[model samples]
Target: MPEVYHLIVNPAAGHGKAPEFVQNHVVPLLHHLGIAFELHETKGVRDAGRIGAEILTTTSFPVKVVIAGGDGTAHEMIEGVLKAERDKKDQALGRWELVILPLGTANALFSSLFPQPPEPPSEPSSLVSYLSDTGPDVLYQLSSLLASLKSTTPARRLPITLTSLESPISPPTEPIQSHIVLSTALHAAILSDSEALRSSYPGLERFKIAADQNLGVFFKADVRLIPPHSGKIKQYDPSVGNWVDPFTFGEDTLSGPFAYFLSTTTTPRLEPSFVISPLLATLPPNPSDPPTMDIIVLRPLRDPAVRSALASRGDEAASETWKSRIRQVMGWAYKGGGHVDLTYPAHRGETEVKGGGEVVVETFRCGGFEWVPTDAEHEPSHIVCADGSLHTIERNGKATVQVMDPGHDNSDDGFWVWA
Candidate 1:
């Protein structure tokens, strides 16, 4: 049980409804429960992290931090907690727990654990995407957190997937420890474009518009899935709901003039109900297993229908047709991640269109991966995204990632969330 409750709230969240709701709904409820608490509202960029680190370092033992914000706010708080200066000798002196209140565009990390379908919001929030849900469901979630804290149920340590971006001009920057997702290709492109539409559209429609803009661009790269030494690379078997290694089919490397490539730590969807990586949510990894990321990759050239259709068409026509197919795949993603279960065969020697013969989506479970984009040939492909933050991998530089689960490996002190 918590001795004190420290809430880091973002007033900007839920279209500025966070403060009003937390104050009226959350505060009174906790007070009624006799929980002692303090509220801290974020002022500017990275302010949440600053506050979180300070609390992690100085807060009383057995403290519970209730983050009344979205994933980005929670992300910053976690980053602060991880980067804070704490004596290694005092690691056992205190206990900390994190609780994200779901107040952003996408509450992918928190939703992965709760998996409760959020109720619709009565008013607009900061962004009108997955995090817009701020109805009575929020009360239920808070109550559940209360139950967990009051009971003996232990919080689960969330595994982080770290990506290191290296450029020849400088040493590798601090690894982006992502609890939800690390993405590039179509995923990053969409985020890059959609962010610009934030003020204009301010809702999920921006993502659709951005997707329309980025669907045609191909990402040129050579990729490799790096397993932990002596471990095997694995892929999801949708038919059986199990994981299997595709190494038997061929070697583990992939070269791409790619359409889509994304990896998830635990999130099954970038937004609620999109279900981009369905199995991640449905079949969470066993505690005894090594930490791994769920990756979804798409290479246009692999589709026979697209290949044959493009062969007869002019270069421009071929590109347009290819984009159409890709849009189809992305469209299927929203249909409960149905894209992964699909088989697109070669119709008229063309694999770009759905021929219904072979599976189009390539889903894998890996320890990490290397994304090396071709120089200038596909500059857009070099862009990478962790959560919502964008990073660009310069020419000749590559971004690599590894899974880190403190609960399983404990090589380093890490983080956990209120389950």
Candidate 2:
């Protein structure tokens, strides 16, 4: 019955590239579909949310909001819809569907959900064709994405995962903020640092720069892994490409001084090459739940050569050591480093860690987690990035993230983008 659709456009997305695409292509396509739409171009950061909230609540039209920007714009639209639904019960629709148009750089969610072909010229039609061609199989692959949404029954509480940062003014507040992608140590730092460089670089290069800057740093913290709805954590057995509950590790499976610790609720592969949670999208335990978080962790102790700390020497020696560390870390990321088989060559000039050593990264799949930063010392654990937005965790406090599944008996139902 909701034939009407609301178009939320971010004119400044992709550093001012989205508007042209929307004007040239998207609008014409909407006309061809014969769909009723009201376009709302975003003004500021939260403008999409504000505009979406307005259209959803004030208008009596049966509508779906199509987000016409990248991931950041999509995220803002979602937050806006949820907030409006939460505040205005009568206007809040039973199911608010989101149709994304990937118009930003690092459109992580869109890219992960629908991988661009290896070749170039990935256009809107190609994406639509992929969706229609794959049929339900795509849904089957993204079971976690769908099921997670249903399980949350977002129409109910609309769960929010908050990461609170400690500041001199405030202690800790209730219900901090929720994030869909990259929540934790390095992820937060990358986003936090990347903001300043966004203007100068304005593209993926900014992310690369941030990664280079933060690659050598590690955060000190203790992690508490909260399992899926079943109250149990799942591990990917690469051999089978499925999630298997690891019964041994419990709440405190992770201790920090970690290099990279990030989690994703939806959209498994951030970039095509960066298969952070290959198993989440490809082989999840349940296909019905797509909202579950795929957590990727990098622990330094897992490094083979890190048996002992290297003493700092002259400027040249320190620079060389730093270079080695960077290359090693970056290599692991490139080779699908499951964090299990990372070995830093110990003796002489060898590459393998002494004795074929420890697992450098410990990856996990779960509903939520709590990151408690080290306060005794001035550690790097003072940051948390939620959906490309930065937030820091309180020194003595923790950040708890749990996946919510908003489900219904309507097996015939789900959200999809119209071609």
Candidate 3:
């Protein structure tokens, strides 16, 4: 049997059921598997990262760390592992692996790992059994997968790109920090405003309220779409059921008083039912490219119903249209709506892209991006969310984000979830 370290556990995940389930089921199963272990708890935001870093620095054995919470906790663990090895040589940092337990409102990361079944809630013991009894082989396979994921170059400090939000009156200064998650535009604003309504709208409804509050407001900004490390900007061709490189005539520039824009690092599906990024799991990141983010967007002006005369009616129409679009988007998400033909409507109800469509949403994969909002107004451009931590954009500024793996080497460590 090998020694393992379980990272921070948030007792409140899944409405406080995770800790009990782990104690009753996971512990005994780990014992049965003959794996030695230890457990740590998070005291506050970002604590998990610190704890994980500590383990990598102080511990001197081959250990596996199991994170018993949701994606945010796991994210911190990953960051901690990367941060711990910053001072060490590159050859030693690429050792640990990550494993997770899904115990949050939206266990997106777990859903990405294990596809959802069209059934009801099973007890935690069943899930525990599957992960502990049936998962070791997967871990062995991951060991091989990781070997291939290692960078061909020397180990270096994995630079994390942070997007800073600054107020317009004041000049922007510090950058917002994150390890796993990052967001801005609509998603960031929704999370920021929705925080106050969390108790009333305990789950996803907060997002709805935030959406409603910010709905008709057009965001004026310039977007620079960077391609992935090893691939081009891929756009889904409905006819092909696969991604093809976006056929742009010139520069891949996007302009807006746009509706939605957001990205994710690991998990594509945000919740159990919300299957937002379906292709993420089937194509995990490779060493040559590394695992990056899939950005999803919804631009309302691309709809054919849009017109200059309707410019005055834009706000009112946009609110209704946005509501309808959101519902449709959710439905499409449920049905794996890769085929939803979102055509711009022409005058007299014609569906065509003669001039262009208004509802054209763009999806892209990239190593990083830049979001520069217009600065002419008193209101902030939008909020930015990094793994649930929110930051408001400063007036007259932009937020930039880039993705890179944290460097971990001989310093001392690797992640191990219970198996």
TM-score of each: 0.85, 0.74, 0.75
The candidate with the higher lDDT, 1 or 2, is 1
Instruction: Give lDDT: candidate 1, residue 385.
Output: 91
Q: Evaluate all candidate structures by whole-model CA lDDT and list the values in order.
A: 0.73, 0.59, 0.57
Off by over 4 Å in 1: 60-62, 85-95, 116-138, 141-144, 150-152, 196-205, 228-230, 247-249, 346-356, 405-412
> Per-residue lDDT of 278-369 in model 3, one digit per residue for the tens?
55544444544543567776665665444332476756775565655555554666655341334445453543322244334466666667
Residue lDDT tens for model 2, 1-419: 54676778888887676667566555665575565668889999889878867876666543456676777886676567666765776643445556566676557766655565443322234235533433353333232223222334331122235444444457654334443475666677788888889989987799889877877666788888876665567765433434566532455557766777877655566665666655555564355553466777766544434433434344344334544565665564545544333444545443442234333345577777877777546445867777777665554666666665454553222233321
Better of 1 and 3 by TM-score: 1
At residue 414, give the lDDT of candidate 1: 57
lDDT of 1 by residue, 357-394 (tens): 66688888878899988756566888999888898897
TM-score of 2: 0.74
The C-alpha stretches of model 2 lying farther than 4 A from their native spots are 59-63, 89-93, 118-180, 196-209, 237-242, 247-251, 289-291, 310-326, 335-358, 376-379, 407-419
> Which candidate ranks first by lDDT, i.e. highest?
1
Q: Which sections of candidate 3 miss by over 4 Å?
A: 60-63, 82-93, 118-181, 199-205, 248-250, 281-288, 312-323, 339-341, 346-359, 376-380, 405-419
